[model samples]
Target: MLAVELNGDAVRAKNGSMVAYDGRMGFKRLTGGGEGLRGMVTRRVTGEHMTVMEVKGQGTCYFADRASNINLVRLGGEKLYVEASNLLCTEEGLRTGTTFTGLRGAAEGNGLFTTTVHGTGWAALMSDGPAVILRVAPGLPLTVDPGAYVAHTGELKQQFVSGVTWRTAIGEGSGEGVQLRFEGSGTVYVQPSERTTLGGQL
Candidate 1:
């Protein structure tokens, strides 16, 4: 569970993610991520839809999604890339949008567009289990399974890699075959458990 202390402030959270709240709080559903018509149209066209609600009060508000482990990310003018299903909440001041993700999205079976959060605020991410934070520096690249990738901060490049071989075609492929390679400087959050991806079974 994630708790947000609000002193008459507001927060944007996933719709129906509120578990409990104290003080006088109000919940309102925002259309198009609070961007109004433009956002609604974009989401409708891209197939990357998000249902968000705004919570405002003077006490504390609780949020949870599927009781999954939550990870907090603090962004300072940097973009955070995360899957739409993994995002739980964001500070009201933060901005959310969708971007083209190429083959990585197809490999995950999560569509070709992923969600991005920017600005300085708190963003909550969810995973099947506790997430591991890995630091990638110059020359120290990181490779992650598509199903295991949660979210990442800072500057990074992602590439799709495959381990398909004759054996793989004959049902003897390595268990850890396809992976998402990340290079550059940043922090990556990976969950211990991996969701079943289309390529993961191969």
Candidate 2:
């Protein structure tokens, strides 16, 4: 569970993720994650959906989702690519959008579009287990299992790398088969426990 204190400020959270609250707090279910009509249309067209609620007023609010471990990311004018289901909460100033992730998103069965949170604020991400933060630089790139990816921030170029071979047809393939390679400068959050993905079985 994550607890955030606000003094006349607001936070956008995953709808129905609030566990508790104290003092004067107002909860409003946001249409299209508070992006209004255009965002609603975009989300409907892209099939990347998020139900968000805005919590405001002076008090402390607690948030949780499926008892997953929560990781807090602080952004300073950088873009964060995350799955809609893994996103927990964000400060009101941050803007949320969607972008195509190509094969990487398909590997996880999460469609081709992924949620993007950009601007300067704090956002909370949830994972099945404790998430490891990996750094990627110009010389050093990070390749991640699609099932383990939770979120990432900074300027990163993602490439789909497959380890499938003739052996894969005979059920003798590496469990870590397909991966998403992240190059450039950024930080990636990966969970210790992998989610069940189509790539994991392939």
Candidate 3:
């Protein structure tokens, strides 16, 4: 997993269980909280204990368990925006900016990251399993299966290549069918899993 901070230092959860610190003062939780959309809707639809927990800070924090190979880079003081497809569920509203899309089956305003963090900016991501950080030197340019590619910088343009198109047309998803080519020097994290899961933050 790659964890880069925009400003202050980010501490990992002591046990490192797909966790992150809200960078807040300690507050006792009276009860456990359910996360993601299910939890939020429950607040409105059922009027149950909708509120999960509270943090006493103004910065964004994140975490990813397992999928260890990582490449975290600071992008000034700005938050790196991502697609919900790229977003695993986050603490409450961290999945904002993930606009609605037809491919994923959501309509509108249905994700995380409602607000932006000011001083401290960072991107934390995980790999499906042990990953290989390939170096695209002069001769040996790295070409990986698209699924293996996780979060690369927005600067990288996506190129769709053919050779396995038939599989995806029928929804078979040829394991190595399509690949997003990164043509620059920015860091790209790749996990070992063929499924190449970016943990849905549920």
Q: Indicate which candidate wins on TM-score.
A: 2
Which ranges in model 2 have alpha carbons more than 4 Å from their true place? none
Tens-place lDDT digits, model 3, residues 70-133: 3343445444433323333233223222222221112112232221111233334445565465
lDDT top scorer? 2
lDDT pick, better of 1 and 3: 1
| Candidate numbers sorted by TM-score from highest down | 2, 1, 3
- List candidate 1 segments past 4 Å from native: none
Models ranked on lDDT: 2, 1, 3
Candidate scoring better on TM-score of 1 and 2? 2
TM-scores for all predictions = 0.97, 0.98, 0.43
Give lDDT per model, in order.
0.90, 0.94, 0.38
Angstrom error of the Cα, residue 28, model 3: value is 12
- Which scores greater on lDDT, model 2 or model 3? 2
